[model samples]
Target chain A: MASVLRPAAISRQTCSLVSNRTALLQQASRTRFSETLRTSYLLRESRCLSTTQRKSPSRIPSNDPVAAPFHTSARRQILPPGPQVIEGGVNDPAPVPPTSPTHGSYHWVFERAMSAALIPLTIAPFAAGSLNPVMDALLCAGIIIHSHIGFQSSIIDYVPDKRLPKTRAFFWWALRAATVVVAIGFFEFETNDVGLTEAIKKIWTAKRKEDSYVEPVLRGVA
Target chain B: MISQRFTQISARRVFAQRSISLTSTRFSAPALITACKPLTQSRPAATQTVPEDEAYSILKAQRAVRPVSPHLTIYQTQIPWTLSALNRITGIILSGGFYVFGAAYLVSPLLGWHLESSALAASFAELPTAVKLLLKFGVALPFTYHSWNGMRHLVWDSGRQFSNKMVVRSGQVVIGLTVVSSGALAVYGL
Candidate 1:
């Protein structure tokens, strides 16, 4: 409504509604003004009041239901973790600088694409009837990276920068170190042991170690 | 005529006094006082004049009385949040297992432990049938559930079936699939 109303657009005949209470008080105080000037001023005030007709911003419909209730200050003051509205006036934007979509728009796409890609990589080894070393490596890398990203996101959400900056930074570094160590461990397992998929397969099928080499089709590699 | 005119004036004064008496008797004292109150209104809450800077501290003190919004306790046990929590737990289990096993494997050369494929197979073979089945089921359940729900999350990322009904239904489907599939894998030991 502030943006809607234009003070400069005030007509010569109509009331200058932008004129503050002091302006009205000044007019009321002046003894030199005739009855005609007083009548015009009173008429202008009445015209302005009649035009508005008790309209307010709250009366305007808003699409955002959650925010609509807190649009007013008194109700907003009751919100949790202390008053969010206390930092600024009701119409003020958040303290953070405006972010550009170009910086992070592809992040969602990349994450989704990577997550989707892992699904195929999971079954491709089994589908091929024999686990290729390259495919196995791919699966391990994908799963590890996916898990790392997932954990990172979880930490970011649970440990916000605003409340616990130091804690968040510590966790961030700890997660990075853990991820690196985990990658090295995965590499060792892949290179030396029967690899991730094959090892899981062997463990799952292990009975009495006598038939430990049996495949999905009951073919013995022994 | 003069006596009649004086009587009229006395009668008017008497009527005014009677009305005041009636008002006092009919209404409560608060109502009478409200009625007598002038056009200029007094504030509802008692206030003291304070410095502008000091006023902020009063506001801060008042703000402290309010509880945080959307508290976990305030929410009823709902499917979407419950499933999301399960997903987090399962993810933790899976990833944590991966990291632990990976680290152990990396350090195995230094520890001189036999973490070889044959060694693992033989050790796993030693476990009782029930234990083996339990372990397989435990591992498989989380894997299948996480896999299925992760797919559901992928679908959500694509911005389809976003309604509460779809999410609840999908979560149920994920749970059902996990139970059936993991149980089958456990029994078959495949």
Candidate 2:
């Protein structure tokens, strides 16, 4: 309004409710201020305030030559909680993520190495023409680990933590616990009974109806 | 008097740029430089500045009506993507199987379940030959395909074999390998 600053007692209160960025944005939106007062100066000034240190309102000069600010009873507007939209705009920068070989490229390398290792592992027993129980258990565990990683990726992609926080967390921990239990099962089968590979071999060669010593058929075979 | 007043504004204009970024510093420095500036900007009464939150509210209203990003169902299927989809599906099947069997095996010791190779084998052997081959083929299809396609993925991850032709060719090769190996296993194992 043309009456931008009236001759009134302006309160100098430290802005405690909203961020300085909000205040800065509010100030920037009024481009007409520069048009009426110092042409084009405030327009350029507001833009440069987007830097990190601008959040501190302590730097605003308490005194100046201009007309004084006054207290108004009108309520200031605030952003509402949207369902999918996240907090902060492009100006608000994310925290710098910590980087190391273990969290970065090495994880990728480890995945590839594990995948490459599996190829040799798959052929090793067949090339030697023997079913070593230890070798069989190791391979099964390797596959489980590989599967666990893949499943985790799927969970990350589909059950995003942003959209479904609780469900994502549940699926993650459940998968981890399930993986550990399955590993245990695989090991037990290997130690106390004929392991996974041998079970496949036996089934492939199995020939008769009356061969089971147990009376009931097993359910839930993976 | 008018010329003198214009001269002061011209002088202030010369140094306005240096103080542009400094809101607090700009006010405090008038003593040092005598740069005359108004305490408040004088805006016209007609146009108004919408608060940041109000602008966001307008944006939020627009977004609520905006269509979401299209899901995979809207996609046109092709060979490469189909093969990629199948690879993932097979991976899920294989991993899911391992989890189930692993749990069963773990509890087998406690339950007195004869999940030993011979017992499971004998149980499976009771099925008719056709059913047996069919079962093997069904399981084998996913297993063999997933395994071979996994190698293809590993190769692709290395940033090689990314051409459209190579992807299609490799996919076909994987399918062929799966059929031949799975068929041989079913027949020979039988």
Candidate 3:
């Protein structure tokens, strides 16, 4: 009985060892097959690259086919030599100096005068009694002009006023019309209609009185 | 023979279970493995041209369903409501101040006409002292509130009073200053 059991156990152990060896052999074969495939692929790539390099000697100067076309095109498009005489000739028209300095001085003087005028003008509305129609008209004109200019400046600065031609023209026309209307109203208010009407009535009365006196003198002479 | 067959079946079952366990262990590698596969599979094939209609539909869906971040509308009103209300009130007072200044400047010059043609002094003398005091107080309240609140805004400009406690304290200080200054000015007729 012991002899039979011992042979069976040894046979089982040998079978397990044979299976382990088969698995290791299969893994080694797979690794070798993959390595051979990689080597063949690399060789094919290198051969194709070398054949193309040999065909185009002028284009592939550095033996790098990827950079060949780029370098050739860049050399072909290089700029030609420039003009021999760089400086201007006497025949060329003289360059005019800019008028910015004159403009700057004018702007400075104008700004100073306007700023001085504005300080007194801001308080003028209050100082000029409300009953004085002439002063009121002047104050109204100043306020309207100030408001219109301020509005136009702000619109120009912040809005897309310049981008749309129609809107820009509309704003320009609106500002001009507003100025005309305000000016007409201000002049109408400033005129002395009451005094003028009274003077006309007095002239008519004096002419009637003279006519009555002349007719009486004629009757007395007859 | 039956016992031998049973032992062979048990050995095969044990090996199958071991292989299944090894396959299960692969899932524990990382979350990126599962995440990347779906993304790659969902991409459109490079060779296929998508219909323009379908492209437009997809873009429209993307535009409509895109997430918007939370804003002030999402937060419930609490202490911030008080601050916003105070700001609005101050803005209204400032606008009213412009009218007040305009009327005063325009009418102050007409005071002579108004006093002579109208019974202005007699009307003022008829009013109760308490009403006179109230009118005086009304004039001082707006100026004091505006001045105190302007100072608080200056503090905010300097970037302090950011914390919730500081906000509450500053609000209290604003109220105290407004009441104290306006009341004192009104009483003293300053």
Candidate 4:
């Protein structure tokens, strides 16, 4: 009876130890699997988060946000393509602010005034007006400067004007001639010994006197 | 027996009162409990994917602004240009003015007629007021235009408003200021 009882107890203890060992192994495997699953889930979640953040669209689309706020709303809207839609194909070379309309009108007014001014400019010399010579000189100098500037501007804008070598040559020659004549006239007037009108009258009188001599000589010969 | 029965009745009464109070509390808070559900349901859908070249193609399809050609044909004979031409003409005129002035000055001393002085005086007296006024104004116009336009040029010098709009506006302002000042001087004989 003692031997049979001892064997029974030993078998029972071995069975219990084996069962405990199997249970311990199973729990260790489950913990490792769960840890691996958790790590994979974390990696997937991080990747998804990064993708969303990077793919988000910007609210304002324009490079020049300050100048063109309307472009943002325009970019958001959808419409059918057409000729008008084709306008948006290229990023408009940064839009140049429109030139002021007032400038054109101002130019027009200036042109009119300048036209009207000619009448006075032309009349001034003949008016025999008691103008201060200094003032007249100043005025002439100013006009010369203005013209010089205008001519230069024209040269820049109209390169073709220069390309026509003959036209350019003629213009320069005419300008030089005008300058010389004016200078000579100015000096002559400054030193003239008689009034312009008196000088003319004297010439007339001398011609008459010469005529009178011719007639007398002819009569004497006859 | 009497004590035991009293304890049982008291416990039953307490249980019934607790049930009535719980029911009333739940009814009072029903609206508050249901509020958050609709907010979660109303979230917007996620954005769809797009092709890489879509933006580039859209930009390419847009129209380009053509450059404007300068119009030199019309009013080619206007003030700015006319003034340029007059610069040449004025040289001739000044020579004549000097001759006239000199003749009158020099001949007046020898000739009793003093043709130069009288001519100078008579010329002034003979001119129409309108013409005289116009000449007076003309004298000032060039200076005024130059000064005002010079300021405009200076503005350009500073590298501000170098745009087409500003250039045009400034050109106009220069002209307007010139006209107003010139007109005022002509009327006032300043």
The candidate scoring highest on TM-score is: 1
Residue runs of model 1 more than 4 Å from their true location after superposition: A1-91, A100-103, A210-222, B1-65, B111-114
By TM-score rank, best first, the candidates go 1, 2, 4, 3
Better of 2 and 3 by DockQ: 2
Interface root-mean-square deviation, each candidate: 11.7, 15.2, 28.6, 26.7
- Which of 3 and 4 is the better model by DockQ? 4
Of the two candidates 2 and 3, the one with more favorable TM-score, higher being better, is 2
Candidate 3 lDDT for residue B44: 14
Candidate 1 lDDT over B1-190, as tens digits, reads 9988756544433333344355656654445445542222112222479996666666665454333455565589988998999998998899888887877777888999877777888798889899999989998888888889999998898899899899999988998998998898798763
Candidate number with the higher DockQ (1 or 3): 1
Per-residue CA lDDT of model 1 for A1-222, tens digit only, reads: 111222222221112222353454345334223433333333322323344443433433343121112111122223335232256655988798577664467766777777898898877755764467888888889888888888888998877776567888999999999889889988888887777788877877878744555444375334
Per-chain TM-score, chain A, candidate 2: 0.53
Can you give the TM-score per candidate against the true fold?
A: 0.61, 0.61, 0.27, 0.29
- What's the lDDT for residue B187 in model 3? 60
Candidates in order have lDDT scores of: 0.67, 0.67, 0.45, 0.43
Badly placed stretches (over 4 Å) of model 3 are A1-222, B1-79, B107-126
Cα lDDT tens digits for candidate 4, A1-222: 011123332323333333364564455445544554443333322323343433322332334211111111112113222221233325667556578756566754554444344345434543653234444444444344344334434444443442355655666666555444544443444345343333422322222234456988999999
List model 3 lDDT by residue over B1-190, tens digit each: 9988756644543333333244434443233233222211111111357796765555444333222323445578765456646654654454344333333333444564332112333344345657655755775676566556655655665588868788778877877888897787566521
